[model samples]
Target: MNLIKTAFCLIILICSSIPVWSQTTGKIVDTDRQPVEGATVVMQLPDSTYLGAAISAADGTFSLEPMADRYLLIVQHLFYQSQVVKGQTRDAGIIVLEPKEHSLAEVVVEGERPLVTVEQGKLSYDISAISKKHIVNNAYEAICKLPGVQDRSGKLSLIGAKDVTVILNGKASTLTQEQLIEMLKNTSASQVQTAEVMYNTPPEYHVRGAAINIVTAKAADNTLQSELSATYSNQYFGSYSGNVNFLLTKGKSSLNVSYNPGYSHIMTVMDLASMHQYDGQVYDITQRQKINTKGWKHNIYAEYGYQINEDNALSVGYNGALSGNGKGTIDVNGNFQNSHNDKVQDSWLHNVFARYSSGFGLDLGVDYTDYSMNDYNHLESELTGHTRQLLDYTSDQKIRKVSVYADQSHSLANDWTLKYGVRYDYTDNRNSQLFNQTEGKDNVDNSSSRLYEQIANLYAGFDKEFANGLYLSLSATGEYYSIGNYHKWSLYPQASLSYSPSEKHTFMLGVSSEKEYPTYWDMQTSTTYMNAYEEIQTIEGLRPANVYSVNANYLFLQKYMLSLFYERIDDYFTMEMYQAKDRLALVYRTQNWNYYQSFGMSANIPFSIGNWLSSQVNATVVNDRNRCDHFWDIPFDRNKWACMLSMQNHFSVGSQLGFDLDAMYRSSMISGISDTKPVFMVNVGAQWNFLKDKASLSLNCSDLFDTMRMKVKNRYAGQHIDLNMGQYSRTVSVKLVYRFGGSITKEKREVDSSRFGH
Candidate 1:
């Protein structure tokens, strides 16, 4: 009886001694009333040894369990100013944040590729921090060195994938893959803001194999600045390049302009050696050759911006480029045969864009692009002696688009919030082509078509975090798309869940569905290319493919991360062409009779041997198969897998000195007669900066270890026939730059990728 009395007395005493504490529950919402999920909330500690932190949910609600005492709370997110609340002693009070103004300037994400990995299916790369080091001569080379990316033709292969589309500010580019590569090759890296590698694209990106958004710099703030750069390279011959930029700002108005010009005289002599075996017998062959190509290009761009009000702004931009025709001749002396070929291509671009935005989370934009090109080809064989024929072709193309979008959010409960958004897009395109034969023959006109494409999207999502160190989110989306022969309405459902058992340990998994539409070339019968033999046909006009995919992504902490994806396509379209004529055909057609399933896995792992340096290896492997009418393997199917492995060295000298190096080993491949042959290739580079980081220099060497190889095999004729080619594949490049640009905002900010529709 006495012991019980003593226990009761002790409990009463402790309760009386404790101070009163208040618990609050509230939600965080943006100006548009949309919930701000994943925003970090921090409670400052008066004592030096402790800190408390929590993250918000998708619905925008958060809770504060009574603190020992209430202190200032700090809230922050990317593209938003930090928000603080005082006298908030352990009580839930609703908090709101204003969106920060943004410049189109590309954003630079930071982190050494060797030391970073996706821990929760979240993948990222920093462009801003990457340009600070002289890793390559220009942005062109720098992108080629991106982690998980392969350089088959330097521009065609991005992240080990092909048929990727590059965009500027979420808009389709006026330049083709080949032209884009040329422009960046002669441009400086200093102009780059950031490059994002969006591997697991959301639902909207299903139409593309990959997307690379190039974010350039916006006009300077209120300060005025200018920058200039020059580059010269001595390899196989020589080349020169120069660039100038100007910026001005007054109050809410800012303007920026850039001019770039380049000239090159590339002449090379090459001797290729190879050996072939047939029935235990060996034959040695050699190709002796010479080539010279020279040309010049100019790029110009100007942009003006005005802040209509605190929550509204207007901007306009114009871009144009003039380029000289490239002249090149290839001479080959192989075995007992001699050959020569002349090539020329003409190109130009004209583009204009405008946009308006309101602080209410509304955006309206319009864009126009005009593009034209011409090509001429001539060839001569010693056995025949004179020129046989000349092929001429020209194309004029135009594209225009307009878009309207709005978004909003609301708070539900403590650690919970809701988000919603809608978007409408309209695009129109037209293209025409002309073809001429050698002797003033009747010219042929390729087909031309004009059509408008419309797309709409809507989504609602919820997010919340738990006091037990757990977070969860659920979202649903509906999208509609319609185009020429391709039309589809799909309901894409996506969900994400995560758990943080502790600070150093976390786990996440997500699932989503997507639909891909046929490209213009795939959907039109006229866009395909054909050779001398009509038997070799390239078909066009394909249908949309519906894909249901489940993603399993995990990051085993800071040292390792991995993502596994499996997808089943309900209706996949593939282009099959007959091979009977020229090495490269210009006309092709398409058919849709095949369905396929593909499974892939990609990973990034980091390891360190002491403090000397750090390294990372990343690779992707996918297996997919379908049917084709051109080649006779089997009506059943043929399966192929592709893989890539890479090694990187960060900070060659030391940490503070800043340096980067990357080398890759991709698997050898064989795909009918058109697939490219694989060979070991390596690139090495170094750079330095002086004069208060205003002046920089960089040098790079490509294909220094081995020759770039491509062998296209022929499946016809009794003779073992194929075209094996090589040239002066090694190249050296250099770059120098000086900048005094408008006041670039130097703030730590974060971006919510989920802000875009699922």
Candidate 2:
């Protein structure tokens, strides 16, 4: 308790010590005197302590507040050469940055490649530079090598972030999580130029929270290029995958297509124990199940683009996936159940965008998606030990949705910007289930629901640099949302203050608000069964969760970062196990929690060991608390502290060969009633490039120590449950990729992923 109090007091003191000074403003321009938007201006003291930083607005104007009159300023941009100037004037006047010629000869070659770079609070990794020394099979593999990125059971997450969204270029991904992972696995690293990480959600992106955008380079030659790859992996079973991608360019038009297919066989086991109380009675049940599944999955994507001019373009894309042939068996207290499942999804999108030299931008897009799934099960039970009871169940579900949106941005005088957008989405969902008993009448359950949502948002923001190395940005968004029968208007405000007291040190504080809505399944009122002992029934009318967050960040020499964050959630909705009747199974439902609170600290450190080895280490500690006695019908509050650590090491033998070692560990934490168990994993991989970079081979062993697993314990009210789930761990994989093209060169391309999504 004393330590916590001391830390709290220190934070308060730091925040309260921020000094206010007179504002200093200046304009940034290119060599030709044209206003340069997005150029970064950083102010630093003589000792290299960071004071503050700002980005030039559309009018190439920036303002800074520094306590001292004299300071050093550094200006940088991708298209311009970096510049430094020392000044003591409150107004530095016009500053010009020399334009950089995009030629290979002018590129600077460093002995050791930088894995990550921080600019304007965003982290970006250069894939091309990293791939020169490491073997990367796909975009996903490259992403795993990035600092502070974690892969948990095939899902990628960032440190200090509750949820993450992936965007292609600047658009939200149209594919689901599984589909996105598969797509990334099939895409070669050579096709991706850079991956940018944004912790603070920008106004242009409708979604809130952290996001990662993968940017791809355009084909330099006016010809066709293609790639083919094959991979094989062994877990408890064998899996095989293959992919083919093609890129074609002619004049101002281009087309890209990719297809991937995979087959896998898996074995799993589960043990569950439950204690339920109802009607003044208690029941204890134990069950063990073993299952085997064999399946195949396919992904197909195609995109077309036409550049009407330098500032106008049109894009269309189609993405689809299908998976089926799944079978499993379960035994519950000597009772047996068999099940099978299949799924299919398809999506299409079209977009048009235009930009003008007068700082005006417009984007319009529309998308449609359809998805369906089917599951069949059969059960046999013998309660009396004399008679055999047979039950058959089948369920079918389908969803169709349409979305349309338009957004525009306009630049104002005095380095201010305004963005506004409107979006419409409509979804129709249908679910049906049939239950049959040999000695009883058949029962059927069916439900059909439709939802229509409309949203309008407006945001205005400004970035100003001040004297005494202080920089600030203030922005707020007002959104009107109409979903089904619920309509409301909300304001999401944002404020940030940063100071660079010296050249190598920087401090920043930010506050923001956002909201999250319940998923379609979370709002469903249908009963779903998990084997014979458990069932789930979710109720409707769940409200969206509102979150207010505060964060403080410190960066040292652009290589080390430490962050402290806190968030408070109101009306949080999540799943919990409940038992309502006597002699009945436990049912899982989504209920509103009164409130949720969390505080966490994270650190990222990157260093080099010797001349050939480099490593990055990241650690985070968090305290989670929840209070919701009223909704649970009992006094239940949760508080727990969790910690996670991840380390990545890269060993380079030369430019053509590289090896990697990675390990991750996470401590248990409480989520609702479940107390999760600890998990740890280690991985090793190596890559070799031959045939003048046209052919590449990679070998990897995942979960080398076989210490990765999921276990959870839940106890609340009159229900107690323990579960240990299976995992696809300890996998050894090998991949070979080949590229064929003519006159290939990396050319930067500006493409917004939002152009296609559903």
| Candidate achieving the largest lDDT | 2
Cα RMSD, each candidate: 17.0, 15.2
Each model's lDDT comes to 0.54, 0.68
Please give, for residues 442-549, the per-residue lDDT of candidate 2 as tens digits: 233554455555556666666656656676667777877776788999999877677877757878777778887776655556666554456677676778888887
How close is every model to the real structure, measured as TM-score? 0.67, 0.77
The candidate scoring highest on TM-score is: 2
Residue 466 lDDT in model 1? Answer: 75
Model 2 poorest 10 in a row by lDDT: 742-751
**TM-score attained by model 2:** 0.77
